[model samples]
Target: MTKYQLFKKLPLFAYVNKIHVRYNPGGPNTETCRKLMLMLLDPKTFTKHPYLTFTYELLSFNERPEVFLTLVPQVPFRFHADTCTLDDIHRAIDADQYKAHCDYLKRRSIESKYVQEE
Candidate 1:
């Protein structure tokens, strides 16, 4: 599948407050990280999560690449960009996002029921 197809509907992003990526433009192992940055910066991704904040840095050639995600609840997840593929990153984020979507649905249901009873 295409990278866009893989990341176009990440529900976890709805629950993400911010994302930060660090990579060295000249680093040999950072190609995937750079590609990820491009994907995250796509207009489709912005349309899907308009409120999401994204920031990135170009590190020195010797520095390691990394991606950081901050959830709405203030939890942080860190990934080593140099060691993983785009698919690996997608799978991890997808799993977390799916769970977050499920939790949001459950919370909405409970809130609605509570309101009805009151």
Candidate 2:
């Protein structure tokens, strides 16, 4: 694939929370994927001054052990080089993609709480 092709654009995103659908932007005409666009928006909720926000582009997949593992070693985790997935987020449902998703949510939650405490 051309270098440009690698960064062209994505086609779909699905966000699942605890085995439940949290958000999905349905694609059309037999398309199951849509380009994922992510941005941070501070929401003005009644209880607090404002809340930091984030989102994920999720997808469906059969159960895979790699799922949670991908998000773990962000700090305290490591894998044998012989078994590494070469940092490819799509190789398994268990790589940077998951980490990115979880990190975004975590930061949002922490920021929201901090703002509330202010």
TM-score of 1: 0.74
Q: Candidate 2: deviation at residue 66, Å?
A: 25
- Top candidate (lDDT): 1
Model 2 residue 20 CA deviation (Å) reads 33
Regions of candidate 2 where Cα sits further than 4 Å from its true position: 1-89, 92-94, 110-116
**TM-score: which candidate is best?**
1
Off by more than 4 A, model 1: 1-14, 114-118
lDDT string for model 1 (1-118, tens) is 6555553666545678788899988788888888878878789988888878989998987888998987765778898899987777667777667667777777679555434663
Clashes (N, CA, C under 3 Å) per candidate: 1, 9
lDDT of 2 at 85: 37
All candidates' lDDT scores? 0.78, 0.30
**Per-model C-alpha RMSD:** 5.2, 18.2
